[model samples]
Target chain A: MSGLITLVSLMYLVSAACYVIGLHMMRTPKTARNGNRVSAVGMIIAVIMTFLIVINKHEATMTGSIVLAAGLILGLAYGTIRARTVEMTDMPQLVSLFNAVGGGAAAAIGTFDYLSLTAGSHISFAFSFPVALDLVIGGVTFSGSLIATGKLAGNISGKPISFPGAKLLNAIVVIVIVAAVVLTIGFPVNAWWLVLTLVASLIFGILMTIPIGGADMPVVVSLLNAFTGLAVAMAGFVIDNQALIIAGALVGAAGTILTLQMAAAMNRSVMNIIAGGFGTGDSNSAAADDVPVNVKETSPDDVGVQLAYAQNVMIVPGYGLAAAQAQHEVAELAKLLTDHDINVNYAIHPVAGRMPGHMNVLLAEVNVPYDQMKQLEEANSMFENTDVSLVIGANDVTNPAARRKGTAITGMPILDIDKSKSVVVIKRSMSTGYAGIQNELFSDDQTHMLFADAKKGLQDIIASTKEYLDE
Target chain B: MSQELYTNIAIFVLSILVGFEVISKIPSTLHTPMMSGANAIHGVVVVGTILIALEAHSVLFYVIAFIAVFLASINVSGGYVVTDRMLQMFSKPKKTDDQKQDGGDK
Candidate 1:
């Protein structure tokens, strides 16, 4: 029995090593897929070793084993199907949903452990503390991630939803959670305290997420991911599992850094996003109506002629591109231009899509070369020398108004598309972006608007460019 | 604290440091895949669920453990599969290899 314990411990260590090495390999695009495979292998090892331990103990009844197996099979089938069939455009919501389940599982484990503690028995601080922490953090992540998924899937409004005294309500929820934790740990084993903690934490999660705007989802998602990691770590402490501790701590640390990085990308603090109500939700349409600025409208044929004849072109894509599933269309257009020897590169803003690096994944799906996707600083520098800048379904990222004072997006970093010789914007209409402010770039003297959906507009431009090249 | 508790704490702290060090190197373009991959790693909770289930004799405990097991399994399988699907796309374009070689020469 002792020997078996040692072997199981060794296997768990090996699994931990796989996770560390796998994450390291993800530093480069070349090794990222293999890295995921390596991590999956680690997971398989951990699961098998756990089974070995359970069987060696001979503690599981036949009925218990059957129930466990059934749960595993059902979950595996459901998860695999969802992962395989989900559209790439909806990857953010799928990720959020995964976070929800992961958090829910951790919370359930913590709750079960707390309940199994003998009634009227003295619970140690060490054991009960982690239980409380796990319940609170896991509860928060589970509910917060579900709300995020709903917002992303358009079941709930993407705009920030807040009411009077929302912040006070949030404060009250936090206080209640803290009081419940103290009671559970300081007093005898009372399930009521745990119940109170769980309920308050769930409400707190919804309160924390509901007030955040759609554009701030990248940070919100990353933050919830970090919460999920912390909750798992707490569960590890409750169960005294080394593998869980290492894996959970690793994810917690990494998710924290990712969240901070995303928040920095948007020039906002995590606290500011959590406070919510940054975006006003289309209220500035009145402002746009007040100013009747001159706008240039162009046809696909004319835009295609310019693109085909230009020596250099830059493509700036945003959430609009992802929304219309126009990545493939745009990639085809880029390829056509590349064949014509018209230098083509894509300018990828850090916060361009719903999640960080989302636009890159969408473009890479259609075989767009990774090298052709330029980061913000690099893309800004090249725009000055480019002959034409094609703005596709992107708005605020390229808006010149961001540089000036007193606007919604003021002081926000923007793509300098106006620095190019000429600019063509492909948008459905001259409307405000997520910031609820008009894009001054739309009315720039050198800017021309091609009013159409991203996919259809790109297809039209592709056909017209072919015609121009043929002629 | 017990000797075992001290050891667990030490392991947790070291793992956190390693996590921060390893992930800081990943570029922004791969952030989504990296995030998804990390999401999969925390599915280690499934082991905890299974352990609890083994000891569960009561119907209430069994039901709770069953749900936990189900959710953790989904998190593990779905998170990894989706991340792999995304990363597969990242590595597919042949031009990326040529571009790397060109950069190497420069």
Candidate 2:
């Protein structure tokens, strides 16, 4: 039996290494598929190891093994069904649900130990602490993730919903929870406070997440994943399991870092994110009403004429690029221009998408070389020397408000595309981003509007560029 | 222990169903913000772990507690890092055609 456990542990270690490699591959858009394969391989190995360990350890009772095997089969079937049917748009919500399942599992292990104690099992204090911690955190993650999933799926309001005295009420609830925990430690036999704390945590999870707007769901999801990891680590401590402790800790740390990075990308403080209700529905509505300048836009043929003849071109991508799913077409256009002896490079702003590094992922999807995607700092200087700066589906991130004070988006950093020679913007219409403000970029004299769908516009541009080269 | 496990499994399944029911109706645009807010609530995990760590009554327990604390700190720091990076866009500039100079003449 000990040998079986050791073998399982060895497999787990190997699987962990594979997972690390897979994650690295997924980071860049180019190798994302390869990364998925690696991760899948790792998961398969881990699953096999888990079964082996479970089978070896159990007394092999027919009833117990049958039940366990049946549960596993059911889980596998459900996962397969969901994976086959879920759309890409719903991927984020699915991720949240999966995370919730992991959290629930951790909490379950802890509760089992607690109940055992109640049934005359003599457990050490060390064991009890981890179990209790896991119960609270895992429970919260499970509930909170559900709420997040609900909001993302559009079953609930994505806007921050608040009532009078909401902040005060939240504070009170937190205080009560802390107080309950403190009292539970001071008086052990009466563990009723622990139960009360659980209730408080559940309510806190719901209330805390309810008021946040839809714009911030990715950050919320990452943070909850961190919680789930921490809860798992606590459970590991209770069970004296080294592997669980290490794995949980790594995930917890990584998830937290991801959350922080996501929040930073939006220029919001974590505290503000937690305490403040985000999104004003009226502001978005008002911003939407900001009428666009109906300039007689140039056609892709004309734009291609300029691109094909120009010595240098810089492509600037924003959130619009992702929405249009035009990255591949843009890549094709760039390749065509490059073939015609025109220099083409992609200028990427750090915060150009809904999340940090979002543009990178989109570009990678289209097989854009890593070297071709220039960082904002690197691309800024090049723009001044370039003949044309093509803007695609980007708005707020490129707005000059980051450097200009007294504006609604003041103090936010922006790309220096204003320094370029000529700019071409491809947009369906002049629309505001999450901040709900008009883009002054649309009115600039050196800019020409290309009013069309991003993907269609890019495709036409690609064809025209090829025609120009043929000419 | 088995009975408790059964109850937990039931709760876990119920939570998933409840969550699915709630999330399926939200519009695509709101998904990002909703997840962000929920992540904040997940911080309770840190507090829970710390509470557990403090309950350690033996040397081995102390070692585990110390490790958990260290890892949790890193987790907190990482969350902040990612958040800061995401927010940097607010101050970033937009790249529009009208704002540029005619560098071709240069």
Candidate 3:
């Protein structure tokens, strides 16, 4: 039995290697598929090895395998089916849901262990500390992720919901939770403190996420994902498992880095993201209303003719494009432009769409060559030389006002679309974006507006370009 | 036991460094898949769930462990499978287009 356990540990080591290497391989698209597969194989091995070791060691309780297997199979079926059937546009919510499950499972393990430990007389600091930590962090992530999903899915209001003294209420909850945690280690008479901590965590999660608006969901989701990872690691310490420690630490570090990255991309601090809320009601900001912005509208045929004649064209895609399911049409437009000897490129912002790299995944679905997609650094430089910069459903990212002072997006990094010789913006309306500000670029003398849904807008351009080329 | 705790701490700290090193290098284009892969790796906690379920001392603990095992398994299996499907869409992008392969995959 000892030898078998040793073998299982060795398998876990192998699985860890696979996960690390798989993440490394994701540096580019070429090996990314293989990277995903390698990590998956690692996971399968870890799960199977655990099964083997668990069943081999338990004789009298072998019947318990039925419940374990049922849970395993059911979870497998539900997760796999959801992952497979989910819309690509809904990926952020799905990821949040996955994080919820991870956090819930970790919290559950910690709760059970802490309860069992308290039933006995001994209250070891080392064991109970990890248990308390796991329950709190896991509980927070579990409820926080669900709230994030609700905001992203529009099932709940995407606007920040804050009442008078909301912050004070949150602070009071934190103090109580901390006190409960300290009590667990100092006073050993009861396990009720653990329950208090759990309840506080659940409330903290909801309160934390509800105040945050849609603009910050990605950062919140990534942070909660990291929290779940940390909780899992704490659970490992509670149970004394090396594999869990390694894997959990890796995830914790990754999520932390990702949260920081997403925040930096938006020019916000992690602390600021946690404390602040953005995107109030639908009222347009004073900036847009204060000025009589001259609007210029153009037909699809004229826009197509310009695109066909231009020597270079660049497409800037954002959340609106994803919401409209227009990636295929964007790809089709690019293909049509190439036929007319116009060099085409896609400029991808780091924070484009709901998640980082979301636009890249969407464009990849339509078989866009990986080489043609430009990161922000490279795309910014290319826009100056391009003849026409096509903005599809992207508002704030391309706003020239970001370069100037005195706006909500002031000092925020933008796509520098104004540098392009001429610009065309496609949108459903003149409504503001998540920033609740006006886009000064709309009134630019050289910019033209082509108001339409992203997919239909692209199709109209494609058809018009075809007619112009034939004539 | 104190020495053993030190070993776990050492592994935890060093692996964290390794995670940052590896994950920091990935471009924004692959962040979603990388995030999913990170979630899947932590699903190793399912191992703990299996151990607890197999030797559950009481009925309540058994129920708790079963729920945990189920959730962890979902995190592992579902996270990987979905991420794999998303990445596969990029497997054979049109190379015939007049653009040079960046070869950044190294």
Candidate 4:
């Protein structure tokens, strides 16, 4: 029996090693796919070893084992099918959904363990403490992630939703949760305190997320992801499994760094985002009244001729481009220009799309060379030398308003598309962006607005450019 | 606390340092995939669910364990698969021979 235990421990150690090595390999895109494979391999080993332990123990009833097997098979099928079929445009929703499940599972494990231990006789303070922590963190993650998924999927309004006394209510929820957790730690056998903790935690999660607008989802999702990891680590303590503790802690760290990165990209603190109520939805009414008189509107044919004759062109894409599914169209136009010996590059802002690296994924799907994709710093540096900058369905990221003080997006880092000699913007209307502010770049002397949907606008430009090239 | 608990704490702290060190250096372009990948790793909670199932004698315990198992499996399988799909696109840009040729035609 001891030898078998030793073997299982060694296997877990091996699996943990694989996780570390695999994550290290993810530093470069070239090795990232293999990194995922390596991590999956580690998971397989851990699962198989766990199964062997269960079989040797012979403690599981026949019905219990059958039910477990059924759950495993069904879950595997559902997850595999969804992952295989989900579109890149819907990646944020899928990721949020996954966070929900992972959090739910961790909370469930903690609850069950606590119940069973209490049924057996005396439960220790150490045991109940981790279980309580796990329940709180996991419960919040489960409910918060669900709300985030709903917003992303368009089932719930993406605008920040707040009611009277919402802040006071959030305060009450936090106080209740903290008091319940303390009571649970003191009285390990009483389940009522833990129940209160779980309920309040779930409510707290919903309250925390609903007031955050869609623009901050990347940071919100990353924060919930980190919460899920912390919950899992607490579950590890409850189960006394080193594998869980290690893997969970690693993920917790990764999520923290990502959340910080996302927050920094927008020049907002994580605390401010959590405070919520940033964007007021797509309020075109207020923006229309404030529209500057200097806005220059242009035509697709004129823009096409300008692009065709330009020496260097930079394409700056935002969430609107992804919303209109215009990646392929833009890629085609860029290709036509490249064929004509016109220098073309894509300037990608870090928070340009719904999630981190979202624009990169969308463009990569259309076979845009990764090398042509420029980061914020590199793109900013090249804007001055660029002959014409094509702004596609993007708003706040390129707004010169971000450079000045007192605006909603004030102090935020923006793409330097205005520095180019000539600028062309494609949009549906003079509406504001997610930040709900007028983009000063739209009223610049060199800026020309081509009012159209991103896909249609790009297609028209491509057609006109093709005609010119053919002649 | 017990010796076992002490060792677990040590392992947890060390793993966190390693995670931050390795992940902080990754480029912004891969942040999405990195996030999804980390999401899959925490799916190790499946082990906890399976461990509890072996001890579940009552109907209530069994039900909870079953749900936990199902959710953890999805978190594991779905996360890794989706992350791989995204990374596949990232890796595709390396073999740009066809795209280069298409762009080269005057």
Off by over 4 Å in 3: A59-63, A279-288, B94-106
In candidate 4 chain A, where is summed lDDT lowest over 10 consecutive residues? A279-288
Q: Rank the candidate models, highest DockQ first.
A: 4, 1, 3, 2
* Higher-DockQ candidate of 2 and 4: 4
lDDT of 1 by residue, A1-471 (tens): 999889989999999999999999998999998998899999999999999989888998887887799889999889989999999999999999988999999999999999998887888888888899999999999999999999999999998898999879998999999999998889999889889999999999899989887888988888888889889988999999989889999999988998898877766789988998653435455546645379999999999899989999999999999999999899889878887788999998888888888999999899888888999899999998999999988887887877887676777788889999999999998777777777888888899999999999999999999999994
Model 3 chain A poorest ten-residue lDDT run: A278-287
Q: What is the TM-score (0 to 1) of candidate 3? A: 0.94
Q: What is the DockQ of each candidate?
A: 0.70, 0.03, 0.61, 0.81
lDDT of 4 by residue, A421-452 (tens): 99999999987777877889999999999999
Q: Which ranges in model 1 have alpha carbons more than 4 Å from their true place?
A: A279-292, B95-106
Which tens-of-lDDT digit does each residue in B1-106 have in candidate 3?
4887888888889988998998888888788888877877777778788777776767787788889989988887778877887787766475543243454433
Off by over 4 Å in 2: A1-53, A59-64, A80-91, A119-125, A150-157, A179-199, A277-302, A354-356, A463-471, B1-106
How good is the docking of model 4, by CAPRI class? high
- Candidate 1 chain A weakest ten by summed lDDT: A278-287
Interface RMSD, one decimal, each candidate: 1.1, 15.9, 1.6, 0.9
By DockQ thresholds, what CAPRI class is model 3?
Answer: medium
Write the number of the candidate with greater TM-score, choosing between 1 and 4.
Answer: 4
Better of 1 and 2 by DockQ: 1
Cα lDDT of model 4 overall? 0.88
Question: Per-residue alpha-carbon lDDT of model 3 for A142-202, expressed as tens digits?
Answer: 9988888888888989777788898899999999889988877667737788889999999
